[model samples]
Target chain A: MDRATLELKKSRAFLCLECGKCTAICPISRFNNSYSPRRLLADGLFYGADNLITNPLLWSCLTCQLCSQRCPVDVKFSEYMRDIRAEACRQNQWGNASHGGALHHIMEMAAAPALKQNRTGWISDNLKVKSKGEVLYFVGCLPYHHDFFAKDFDYAPLTAAVDTVKILNHLGIEPVVLDNERCCGHDLYWLGQLEKFDELGRLNLKEIEQTGAKLVVTSCPECALALKRLYAERLGGVNFTVKHISELVAENIDKFEFSEVPLKVTFQDPCRLGRYLGVYDQPRQAIMAIPGIEMQEMPHSRRGAICCGTTNWMNCDAVSKQIQHSRLTEAKATGAQTLVTACPKCQIHFRCSQCGDESQKVDINITDFVNIVASALEG
Target chain B: MAGKVSKTKKKTAKAKFVPNIVAFACNWCSYAGADTAGINRVQYSPNFRVIRTMCSGRVTPGHVLKALKLGADGVLVSGCHFGDCHYIFGNYKAVEQFDRTKALVKTLGLDERRIRLEWVSAAEGTRWGEVIDEFVAQITTLGPSPLNHKPKSRK
Candidate 1:
């Protein structure tokens, strides 16, 4: 087996009791019949590099931690799959790129040293953003989301970058807005382009350090997760503290006046925000603070909730559609008029799924809770 | 249910206002209800282009958006009343699906009033007639669909 596969085998591969709980809860396996986590772990132990490295089934996992939640032996199937994907990527055997590598190409471009990106056009004339401050608001890939999803659907989560800054300003914070901010290397790292991931990480850190910012806040859970956990895991540690916008807002939620929203809504806990970092209550607490708005719990939420379907922009197919279908249906069944998500990726994925097929669209409004809270803030 | 709705002032200079309404009638209930309405001489407006489906659940949000995107001045998704579907949960599922698309339609510059989702059973032919009249009048007041002038096909 490959090095990553071998490492996984030495760690938890032997611990898997062939219980098949991972496959039972895996979202991908719901539509795809070919995959089973227990079987894959077993194969990782017994199979050689030839059988393990080139197996395209390695890319199907969303790395969403549903399998790990059910694992009797506590084998982290998603993490192991990510490691395996790194090995596969090293051998140039990766999942087929969806959207014609439009997103991947953008992340890859960020990997270039001394990279210059025009990321601030989305900032309107009225918004005042500080160039230097103790707080550096990391606006990750929202510009790309704006341009990419604008033609078909209104991906308002992209505006969370601006709204995040506005919310910061509301709390008497002037966050440092980087002019040439690079794309957060979360997707690339997951895609197993370790060298590129490393380069972007180092570059992003260097940029943030130059801003003299002690705190790095981002609306995207993926960026926050990458900066807080993954970046530290890869490169010893960093000086700055990373906070997902929920944590940032949750601290000062009482300071703002919340107008009555008069709407029932459900929240989709993005895997990065919930399962990975254990930020389940912060978002809910923030939303619940709004007067007259009620929170209805979906049947599957928090750690057990399904993904918005399609991760790393890879292998978006019928299975991904089914997962999206199931998730929207779950939210719809709750009878909430809106579906709120912390992560922009989740918002985009859910909204995109609602597009193309008119019949597939859900009536639920999808947006970052920050925007709603921002709307409710007193003038 | 009114028929002759006053044309809105916003589109005065455009082609004489004729609202195109696409009705997704479920095969079991709404479609048969429309046929029953015709047999009973319900005398509803002639603005509807009805599309029949196997069940109310089969009318996905994509179909509604496609009709609107293709310049259907209005889309009327009529299904079997809740729990009255020929398929056990089709109407319930259809209502849920409609809820899913409601926010989306509002976002796409289509008036929430333009797209009407109703539970019309095969037995309620008069109800179907009334709904058609109400919706046609609603669309007439809303004027031409924003997507009407942009005739290019979209995916």
Candidate 2:
């Protein structure tokens, strides 16, 4: 192993004791026997990356971080997978995009400093947002999703984006909504396109600084994580505060009016929100504050929540759908009318899973938590 | 290509002859108006599925587009009369969102006439009934929504 690879192995992967605990808890491993985190690590440690990188199973990992959670030896298989993915992307060897790289191309284009996107044109006039405020709401690739997934997914994507602003408005805070907001480069960083991710981070930080917002807020956990954690690590330290919408909503949960619709609902914690950022209670606290509403527990709730599956627009195979189908079945079994999720990707993936094959349909409504709060707000 | 063709075939086979209407009724006025219409026993089309939001401004382009994509033959958004919004300017936002949603749908080549936004106040029970009758008549004439035959992505 190279020095960088060896350092990662020593600090993380080398500690693996081959307990198979990660594989046991893995959602993909359960369905697809050919790909196992433990076996992948074993192969890497035994034969090395040169041999293992050629294996197609390398792309199949969801990187949901369940293995690290259950691993007795604290081997972060997801991070390891991310590192491997980055290397493969550098070599131009990666899985196919389900959308023919349209989304990836958009992200790649966003890395440029001169690209002026007409992306924010979709911001409806009803939203009371500005280019400068004390708070900056980093609108990520949501506009792209708005256009791309329009035919397949509901206005759920755009609804989450707009409701996020509306909820901020309800909180008496008019967010600095940047029309020139660039992608957070989360997809790039995770896909191993590190320099492109750094450029985007630099570009967004420059734009956000011009607004002079003291706090940065976003509905997308991926963007929030990238802003709060990765930007500081890979680029430089961000001077401002970055918070997911749920955190801010939980802080102001007492101020909102609650509604009587969908009295009982369950929350699907996104892997980034739940595991990456440790934001579990904020979503629930906001949910439970609504009058006559109850938050149901999915069999896997909080830290144990199942991932919506599919990652970085790569390796979206049958296992992704099976994972989503299992999670939705679990959600429906809870008898909750709606499954309130904090991440738009979760809603999109869950909805996409339900789109194909009517047999996979479960009788539960999938919605963003911000939408729920926005809908339930009385005044 | 095979999957796409099969999907189209399946959609046409189980088509609903009746229009599937999704209505966004504002809470303070239009929703109350709907209640009054029910209380008065005013007959209207049974195809309408009403979702009550606090204000019409709460209805975004996504909601209307989603409704249409989910096979809604028509989406009717009713709220407090202009300048009469319970929240002062919510109806205006609804109007803004309605126009934007309509534009986006038309740009996508879907029929713009499938969506209608109106003002129905709390005391407008008769008006509520008439609106439904009119929207149903309009949708029936427009035939089923292009989205109606498409597969539903929501679970």
Candidate 1: give the TM-score of chain A: 0.96
Candidate 1 local lDDT, A138-247, one digit each (tens): 98888766655655586654668878878888888888888877777888777778777888888888888888999999999999999998889887699999999889
**Lowest summed lDDT window (length 10), candidate 2 chain A:** A2-11
- lDDT over C-alpha atoms for residue A85 of model 2: 65
- Measured by lDDT, the strongest candidate is 2
Report the lDDT tens digits of candidate 2 across residue range A1-379: 6533553563388777999988898899888988888898887777665555567887787777877888887887877776776667666786766554545655655654544556566578888888777998887877767765766555547778888999999888989887667789987777767888888899998998899999999999999999999999987799899999999989987777666654679889899988889998888888888877877898898888888988788778888888988999999989888888888888888888888677658767888888888888743
- Model 1 segments beyond 4 Å from truth? A1-4, A9-11, B1-155
Scored by TM against the true chain B, the candidates give 0.84, 0.85
Q: Which digits, one per residue and each the tens of the lDDT, describe model 2 over residues B47-145?
A: 799999989898876677667655678999999998898899888878776776665555444577889999999998989999999999889889876
